[model samples]
Target: MLKGHDFLITVKAPGKLYIAGEYAVVETGFPAILVALNQFVTVTVKESGDYGSIYSQQYRENSLLWKREGNHMVFDNRDNPFHYILSAIKLTETYAQEIGKKMKCYHLRIDSDLDSPDGKKYGLGSSAAVTVATVKALCHFYNLPMTKSRLFKLAAIAHLDIQGNGSLGDIAASVYGGWIAYNSFDRNWLKKARHRYSLTALIDRKWPQLNVELLTPPKELSLLIGWTGSPASTSHLVDAVGLKKAEQVKNYQKFLHDSRACLKRMIKGFQTKSLATIKEEIRRNRKLLQSLGVLSDVQIETPLLHALCETAEKFGGASKTSGAGGGDCGIVLINDSSNTQALLANWKEVGIEPLDLHVHRVND
Candidate 1:
């Protein structure tokens, strides 16, 4: 199945978890803090004997052929589950042309463990991770000089082209590959940049407003991630909340102020390792999210998620639902590692699955 002198390239990207600043991050220029998890989505590309193809190990699919047609690449069928992959390929082809380069024909294989053994989605930002991996693989395969900013912008474009809405906090975590204090890029600035230069040129030029900084968690603090076994559609929840925010301008503005204050305290708390400060801020943040749910008539903080948070608080830890939070994962932060076992046992009793995740440090 292999040809002599065939080339192979592999690339991996970490999944992300939001620590704070959820709904507010999408407000043009707001920021969110997230940590890249240990779990990764990897993509591999190897020269094919015939036309180009793609295979997904996670999806357990056979190779699907693809070919270049004029200035674009077309797959065997357009109705596949992995539109993320297809979007990456097409976008990369366009990037290559914009930068005056040629793309080679190769077979791409994607693998991910963000899903459970029974195929339950963990709300780990799989689409962002997959897009990052695909872009990295294509850049590596073509020997493109890809930098972190370049990769992030390209992947963000590909993802935006499909989903049409997101704060891009997940993409920032994947590209930076660690705990980060991130502010969303200015939409107007990015629009101008897209019109002014190619992606390659944009990478070389500095916008100065794009804010991404790395942060190290203190040694005393530990995190526990628990899944609710139910998946939440982020788009649906965001839309519901967005519609309400438009109708309740005064309430939304007040919520934003409180959310920003909580996030500021949490960031400082991480630096100081002040358990009391962190716990209070997390509690306030949780309360705001609950209010958002009530205002939108959406279950942003479902009873199950609230129970998990309360249980963690009862055990002297602070917890809240991570991300959009109707039902995916809740993050628990504790000062002592000794509490981990007890927390896990209690979570098990309540049917919450504990995820084995940690901060992922990127290699320079």
Candidate 2:
């Protein structure tokens, strides 16, 4: 049933950056904005004779041999670095079975441009991009049709099974590609649904409170990103906030309300193409995140991050840390492109490295 050794399929999924809504977006129905970047994780699948191999350019040491064991994948190495890829394979193959598609052995290779050449993470959601790429590659290999929504659900399921937290906005950005406004679905409902429904059945049903809308940013809007040269673990920061939520129940509620309001105004800015409204909300959101850090006793913004924001403010741009930031990138929104060169100069003077990334839009 092999197509031939020459048969090959490749798929690439773009990395994502959070534009707004960090800590609060983890809760169900909370809104956030994100953009897909041109940087991507690419997966290539080649038809194999009998056994299969999985390799990663970034994790060369973790390459291993695998074979099919009666509808299940059996790996030769236990301590492999391809957890997200393996999960994607298993889930997609399971869905393939439900659709009566035959499974075949193949050699899978992964390559990523999501990190620096020296292997430093830029907080660009590499894991999510890789997972999405794996699922997409397998779907193409199996001749399965994948709509954006279906791809998102399959990838989200695989990702949630592994890391088990966060808003999955990165996954959405990878699948949908471009500027998106996302509201997270109820994870508790999803946890229960997994027990009652098959993978195929679950993906077909609508997820509660989940929403993803493509946004068209104003033509005059100029977005600038500056990296602080330090990687922060999103899971760690989110976990810290989770632990403090019970103690600060009322404060958490207020933060959620304020975040929702702020996001609504920003979304309106996007709709009306009002750069001023967007900038004001960005500044407001920054203050809210600072307050959140104090309330949760977590250091969301590092000293370098503060400098990143202050420098942007001084250059006439509204800015804040992009993601769950103890350290990582900061984003600035400005209408005047003239200030960009000066801002980048000042950012470099203050130890911030300006990253040349732009919003990526996918062709349908």
Candidate 3:
């Protein structure tokens, strides 16, 4: 049930995904197209008490409510998701001043349900969805008079502020939902310094309506979704890439460039929308990721993942890392669910487990 103050917006933030082409976007300065996943971070806002307060469920798990005064407005950190929501709100408040929508204090209860709670691979970017949703709600709450595109740009900038060096791909995909050619680096945006180097010369561009499917593994899908059990820290990993960037600029950028090309090839191949072509492209992209540091030999393609692919050969599709590959839950795309019973039992025979997921795209 979605409640509102006559203009309340009910929005579901989609999950972030890197289907292909990473590390390359960092320096070689290529474009990467990301898509929004089906699972989401849902938010619902209703009129709170008198002061217009925000009630966050996760924050209540820690403590009830947190209130503080800022340079311009009195803000409250009601919960984890709303905390980021407040950051976006504050920024919007400033932007509103630019036009003429003066905003005062208001109490709003923010409801959030983002945990994989039982600890499944719900993936990151779920909170990012909430951040996006919260920002949209705030825009409506105050009649901020901002367009969706304006709100998206503000949300990306705000997400970076919250994550402390966010790549901006996740937020972009979450907001846009489909496919886009996104590159985080631009000498134009990177620095005010004018460079003779033009982004046009080195880049090849195209925008295609992507066809993504939620692959349902067979009943006995020989799938082993091993949790490296250790979540990699995004900041440290980005720092490591940065440190290496200065030393191995040419080699690293080349890998990313090649990877970006591989992604383009895959997206182009999808024009025919053939399963065989998609699998081959995925294999090529896996090799490219392995060549780059994003997907390592051992970590990205674990013995379990490899063996699972081999076993899934009977069912026959492909497998690869769905995101930054330092031991996150990777995906195995199956051909058809025909032999589901036998295939899934085989997964149990080995040590791998399956996840309850579908590779779905967003509705227009």
| Candidate achieving the largest TM-score | 2
Clashes of 1: 0
- Candidate 3 on 266-336: residue-level lDDT in tens? 66555555556656766777777666564322244556656655665566756666556554455554555
Sort every candidate by lDDT, greatest first: 2, 1, 3
Error of 1 at 7 (Å): 1.6
Residue pairs in clash, model 1: none
lDDT of 1 at 162: 68
The best candidate by lDDT is 2
For candidate 2, the per-residue lDDT at 346 reads 88
The C-alpha lDDT values of all candidates are 0.80, 0.88, 0.55
Lowest summed lDDT window (length 10), candidate 1: 1-10
The parts of candidate 3 lying over 4 Å away from their true place are 1-9, 27-29, 47-52, 59-83, 108-114, 119-121, 145-148, 179-181, 185-230, 294-314, 337-353, 359-364
Evaluated at residue 106, the lDDT of candidate 3 is: 61
- Per-residue lDDT over 73-152 for candidate 1, one digit per residue giving the tens place of the 0 to 100 score: 86643223387788888777777777777667888888888778776679888888888888888877776778888888
C-alpha TM-scores of all predictions: 0.89, 0.93, 0.72
TM-score, predicted candidate 2 vs. hidden true structure: 0.93
Residues 138-240, candidate 2: write the lDDT tens digits: 8888877778888899999988887778889989999999999999999999999999999888988899999999999999998899899998878768888
Residue 301 lDDT, candidate 3, scale 0-100 = 50
